[model samples]
Target: MGSRRTFSRRLGVPGRAGVALFAAGLGLMSPFAAAPASAQTADAPAGTWATPPPLGPGDAPPADSGHPDTTYKKKNECVQRSLGQDVKINFRPWGQDYLQLDRAQQIVRAATGSVGGNQKVAVIDTGVTPHPWFQDRVESGGDYVATPDNGAQPGMQDCDGHGTEVAGIIAGNPKDPQVGFIGVAPDARIVSYRQLSENYAKDDSPQQPSAPPSGGTGAPPSGGESQQPPAGGSSNSQLPPSSGGGTGSGSGTAPQQDNKGDSRDLAKQGTAGTLNTLAQIIRGIADTHRAGVINMSVDHCRPGTAPGDIQEGERKVQAAVRYAADNDIVVVAAAGNVSENCPQNDQADPNKPKSIVTPPWFSDDVLSVGAIQEDGGVAPFSVHGPWVGVAAPGTKIVSLDPAEHSNGLANLTIANGNPSPIQGTSFAAPYVAGVAALVRSMFPHMKARDVVKRLKATAQHPAAPGGRDNFVGYGVIDPVAALTANLPGDTGNLSLPKPVVQEAKLPPADGISSTPMIVALAGTGGGVAALLITLFVMHTIRRNRARSSPPTK
Candidate 1:
């Protein structure tokens, strides 16, 4: 009977037009057809010029998706050890080199005495773990991703090591010489806001049973989709295998239960409340009036989508950005690791071409950062568009790691330890944020808008067309320039020259017109003589008249 059913299914193949219609219905055909010739090149390398893979279970939602996209390099492939005894003590991350931090430090010291001193930087990500490097400077801003079961205290813990890495990049102090990694702004204070949950959705709602494809039986497949473990954690090996049992010999078979309901509930428990929670937290930060810069290394990139109209969640984030801006807080966000345009919302909307992503795309007030390689080229995975404000060193960036693994084991191996190196726009945003802190520290009276303007104006324009392309925006951030360079603000006025009073120049002696001068002088003298003669005649007449008048008196 099974063989007969399979044979019958094989006889019902769809025509080419039917296949085309199905592809169009899914909105897949247009993206491929409309893709540029460069993207469609058959000879292109495997990972280059390709759309990023779809988001998976371990990934955060679109709001906090600024985590590294490891399509180019696997997580294990990018690991590095902390500097050892024989290693040089002055080892610096490529990002620091790109920003010219040494020169910036000298300039900053000459001007402000220290780098990012007394400035508060708020890192909004997974909670930062307490590490020796940031022990004295780290402050808790409370966890926004807390669930009923997990409570809010765990929000301060770095379950996935992402937040710790980001915070370390911004302001990890160089206290431990053994771990020779230093943040861009070593003296800056860090305030952590834990917003992303450590776990992913466990199960998805089941699809209705459909007819089996050719050569397959009607029985449902065993097991659900495999879940990848979150970064820096081991896999969950205890999850039960999906039920696929059947009954025999007239015994009725009980249908296998699905975890769809449980999955939905878990998702609600974890992420349903994130948008409002994040918005409130941002407002709270602004209300504090302490944070000089807020480093939001998170971004949302919808899968299989082009940039489209704004969604409600994105609008809420934009409002929060506006709130931060209104309160004089500089907000810096990742440009996302997805290699599409910014502001990609709906994958199914054919009218929307690939563009920039939001909340950075939503407002020019926000600084949207892209990633660049050591050679100063845009990283293949860095998202691009007009909304991007600047690029930073994101590839192979070395920073702090969580102190321990989720299993309570120390997060150290013989080959590598706490100074874990990562790469993404996530880390890139912090570099810019650190620079912003330095700017704010140096110019305490400068407004948030002026600080943002200084960062962009002093950025090193790349060698691309227009000097500012969609890939790297204005170009890689120059920390020294941001610190020392004089930049114009949004309302920067030109310094006009003062009005000058010029004395009239006399002609050379040989070039003077002597004839006209003599004529003028002689005419003046003749006129004066005539006047004198008339006056004398009048006086004589008056004397004779006076004599006559005296006789009459």
Candidate 2:
């Protein structure tokens, strides 16, 4: 965790002594940074932080206006008390896996019957927003935070760029076709679960910047109320109402922006409750067998020796994943973006062991994904773990970011777009999840366990291993290899043929001269003339006999 070097891929060669590299400049920073928990790094490029277009009084459209679903109202009310999007933070890109991602996609198409036909794949992460990639891609799963009254909607609006970016990777279609960074199965449906909506997406909570940090030691809240902070704490900040018009810093003047639904009572410990509700919804989907695959790009890091504690909220959430799998759904997760300084029993923790990811205790069904560099090496930021199942492209990987509609595929290649270069395990998990959908699409009847086996078996080994590596588990998932590699076809349908009829013909009369029938008839007529003369003689004899008999009488 000492020397920092920028490798082409996020996770570089596994055993080559990884130097934990932190890209705080990108939107992703260590959880321990001193800045406001919601603050984006100043190092991010101009466009990401470029003043969002002057949001007029009606500029930031109401979350429920155009959508027919009523769930928007419920979710908006639930998250109104939290911090909203801060103009200062730089929105990070999903990073540089575009080329490899494209290749992987091709392989999926060749293998799967069709790219995820109408199947909904839900990504439960920080809130997501509508981007060109997903402009028409999402359907409402209900905004869990924006309005709390209901729990379903069509648009997956992202206030924080994180969730939207992850969703885009899972199912985004680029505006510019010239740059091919389309998702693995762009046609597949997407469900956005607003899990990381707290400080990240909608934290209107009064910020007493001067208050001391408690490091999350407070007791869990009782009942479904917002838990109030200890006494002497300042109240939550009131966000300037959203403005409809004006540019730069001036956009905060609008009145409607401030009316972002109703605030929840802070006395209730509602974060956990909110999560439980989200989990129940997910479990319900699994029970109904709705989504073919579910991608969770969010993870809670737990310290060593803390046997069962991982965010009291996460413990409940992971159980939901198990429940989903019991009903035959596939759950995929990010290992985490905390590889830079993974703290171990007090030393630099250089054992290069499996202490990185969470829900970390082995879950056979969960496919823990670690990030890898373009050179087929482990990304510097990727967390390693024993539970790791496979790897996908996660370095400087290009993906959809909702905050700035600027395209990642185009921005990465060109210099002009608000290029906030990004890297993390968040980008990696979707690639695999998308591929999993492809696998399921092609082999619709294959069990989740069988699909896992095919993915592992098809994965090609990278330059550094006899088998699986700590950095690139089973090597960067070879989509072409994974999809085409000995996949047995499903035998659910077979078409039988109908019976056929044949006509018959008689051979020409045996030896009748083989001439015309008229000629044959004329040849037989000469024989009939001789028979006529014989009949005349017999007639004359009968007449003479009759005359003689009359005389005798």
Tens digits of lDDT, candidate 2, 317-434: 5566666676778878776555223422122422223242443322455676777666766766566543456787665544553433333321121101111233467668888888
Clashes of each: 8, 66
Question: Listing every candidate in turn, what is its Cα RMSD in Å to the true structure after a full C-alpha superposition?
Answer: 22.8, 25.8
lDDT at residue 128 of model 2 (Cα atoms): 52
Candidate 1 wrongly placed segments (more than 4 Å): 1-90, 147-154, 176-180, 200-273, 303-308, 339-356, 405-421, 463-466, 488-553
Worst 10 residues of 2 by lDDT: 224-233
Best by TM-score: 1
lDDT of 1 by residue, 317-361 (tens): 666777788789999988765522233322333223254344555
Score each candidate by Cα lDDT. Answer: 0.53, 0.47
CA displacement after TM-score superposition, residue 473 of candidate 1 (Å): 0.7
TM-score of each predicted structure versus truth: 0.57, 0.54
RMSD of 2: 25.8
